[model samples]
Target: MTVFIMVADVFTGAHVWQETAPRLAAAGSEVHAVQLTGVDAGRPATSASIDLETHIADVIAAIDTVDTASDREIVLVGHGYGIHPVLGAADRRPQRIARVVYLDCGMPQNGVPALATVPDQALRAQLAEWAQRGECEGELVPPARDEWQRWGSTAGISDAALDRLTALAAPQPLGTLLQPLRLTGSVVVVPTTGMLCTRNGVSIDLVQRLVDLGDPMLTALADSQVTFFELPTGHWPMLSCPAGLADALLRAAAGEGRSLRPVGAGVPPAHLRPFPLDVPELPRDRREHVDLYVPDAEGPRPAVVFVHGGPVPAGTRPTPRNWPTLVGYARLAAAEGMVGVTLDHRLHDIADYERAAVDVAAAVELARADPRVDADRVALWFFSGGGLLTADWLTKPPAWLRCLAASYPILAPLPGWGLTGSRFRPARAVAHAGALPVVLLRAGRETPEIAATVEAFVTTAKDCGAHLELVDVPNGHHGFETLDPPEEIRPALHHAMRSVVTHLTS
Candidate 1:
């Protein structure tokens, strides 16, 4: 087996893998620490012009140089910002790569830049300021020795190793951080492992929660056979805890790590059971399936149709069996004495708003026709992009619909949807909603564009005298309901859920 290690920003492969590579090699595995083009010479010159593509090329070339026969099993290990290039290389040659290991770094996502992946808003702003000042010619220079010192001993790097790393550190190209990643969706099938650093007090459970919450990068990894291990050291575990990092990587490569638990497992409790709904109207090409979580109560209960959001690519389908959040919500609805229905809809790219509306209508009809559901008391629940398809219902809701609820929904027409030929302003629909009750669950830190659209809808609904109720989750972000909510905001999530259920059942 050959283990290819990718170094973090500003540091050479030798500096990053000095201790870890030897341990792996001693254990009878081949080790190759790939050096980026500019950093391979020990330091990047000020005049160097490097970007993400250059680093990706460097990784591919290293793989080619090491795996001449291409018969050996290879594990791609990337630290820090190295994950981006490693992902690009893996997407290019997924057949050759067995597993990708993210070592205390952010996971890579399609079309997301390295700079955008930085979680800290203040730091991103500072970097933007530096870029504007032409610092390092619009590149991000390595942090000074003093700056590294201020990072403190938390990373657990030895003084000698720290000195070597700082001495060898060089400027990284801004283009690498700014450029968006391009992927062909092949990398999603490859096995992934996260060697998380716990110095920031993030646990493996917290990471799993983030994945469950639909954090895009974590979700991508989790969708595959992903595993996680926590390193008690700082972000630079290769430098701080090389022996342990090496062992964890070896175990992950050998398939010794525990697989993530399948979502929506086990029985739905004594009060609820899964009921399959037949939606013959769904396109034959799409996943034609729907599940109804019917309460074990009396007949003719109020029901709610759960529409999972998408444009989930062409190949993948979102289902309650694969997403526990959907099942969880359905269970919650059942617990509240309502028949909960979840259904599969075509991707936004493949199906127009009209087509999705038809699917929703079919699901609603299925619920209405069910012996256990109250046809006149049904409600519609939309999440994320699925909200875009509800324009017609908002404009002229059916007589049987009790209310409409949307969480972190898309209310405007965006690119990639064939919306140029259609008129699909959700605000316009809201303005003509009449007296139909509408509940909107909003995340406080939602993107500016979404916030603006939500604001417009609220204002329009108010002006039109529509029965609109806004539930603002001050501490929440988008997908908070499905994603693990922080302790403080759990109550808010529950309150929002209760509010929606009340609106439907009242």
Candidate 2:
């Protein structure tokens, strides 16, 4: 028999998993929803001074309850903020885990600090939203009922359930959100997968970003074993559409492909051959013609335009080392019959960052106009400098583009490590903002020095009113392009991407 361990997002107790566990159990899988340190499983409660180590210990203790059966393996699923604790538990007992899934969340890299890798524009608004609820010693309080609904999707849940969630949600442990996770061994070696629900009224854009980032994090492996699937539901699939969500869990537990659609629903968009698009020239006098990939057989499918780093020269097409995490996403989106566009934006030297931002914005407008693309569902995918550019574009973007999926984008103006002439400052970016759903990913292992910067951004964003998700991946790096990453990295990336994709597409 397969075992399922469920973890709740921050401020949400184990009851958040109440509506989800039985569905898995009915499908011949054993499910366990764990409550981290200082959180009560039944009633609403809050904690203070609780740190990552405390949460890690709680997860470890929960996992120990599972009986050791030589025949089958345990599948641990960490949702939202719980990813940090779940990963720490796996690190302590990697051998016991059959596979790990970060339901809409990803693990952090070593040496990187906090969830700072995500852009500031999106994060700032979210921080401000949380702060309005009232601050308890620096950390923002959880949202009220209407506030949660505004930022999150509450589809299938009853009115009473929604009220309970709002009433019970409390301020999360400030230290835990700021803590960077550390991975001990090769966690990816265990079969890992990411499941994203891409229905309306969710956080699909953020999920896709994590899915694409999975490529580089999982490149050490020869063949792509990591599974990435999209569900047409909201972020809280368990609460929104429990039956469809349970089906996905069963498939992953069985190591089966998740391409099949919801219960009786038709299959996802038919697979199409990877048709290459003619390179498009940049408007104005720029000398660059970006390499473009747009699907051939289609009437408006979900479309995404990628923006790579370096303004003078656009970042290269995702290679296994640099962008292996994106392969499954591009393939899956293509399979879903969506128009996928990858472009080279001018690098730092070729054009000013602002100019590059305009270039990306133009690409969004172009994608929105394409017949094979869904102008209403267009998304922007960016990383590092690309992230910086995307945020800049979002600040004053054209009216057409709908959502953004920016991965580890640079928002501040301070110089990054070893990279002179580049500036990133967290405090200055969120000075003005609006409602934007953003999923932020950061590695604790690679960029520890920037942890403070990320925290500042997250706190500020919470202070603002925006939808936010902050994930900490252990053994991760600045770009997550390291060779032979501890196996968990890519799976976590897939998890995060799946979450963003759900929000954007749904």
TM-scores, one per candidate: 0.51, 0.51
lDDT of 2 by residue, 79-102 (tens): 766777877788788889887776
Model 2: weakest 10-residue lDDT segment is: 269-278
lDDT of 1 by residue, 313-351 (tens): 334433332455566667677777787777876643423
Best by lDDT: 1
* lDDT of every predicted structure (CA atoms): 0.68, 0.56
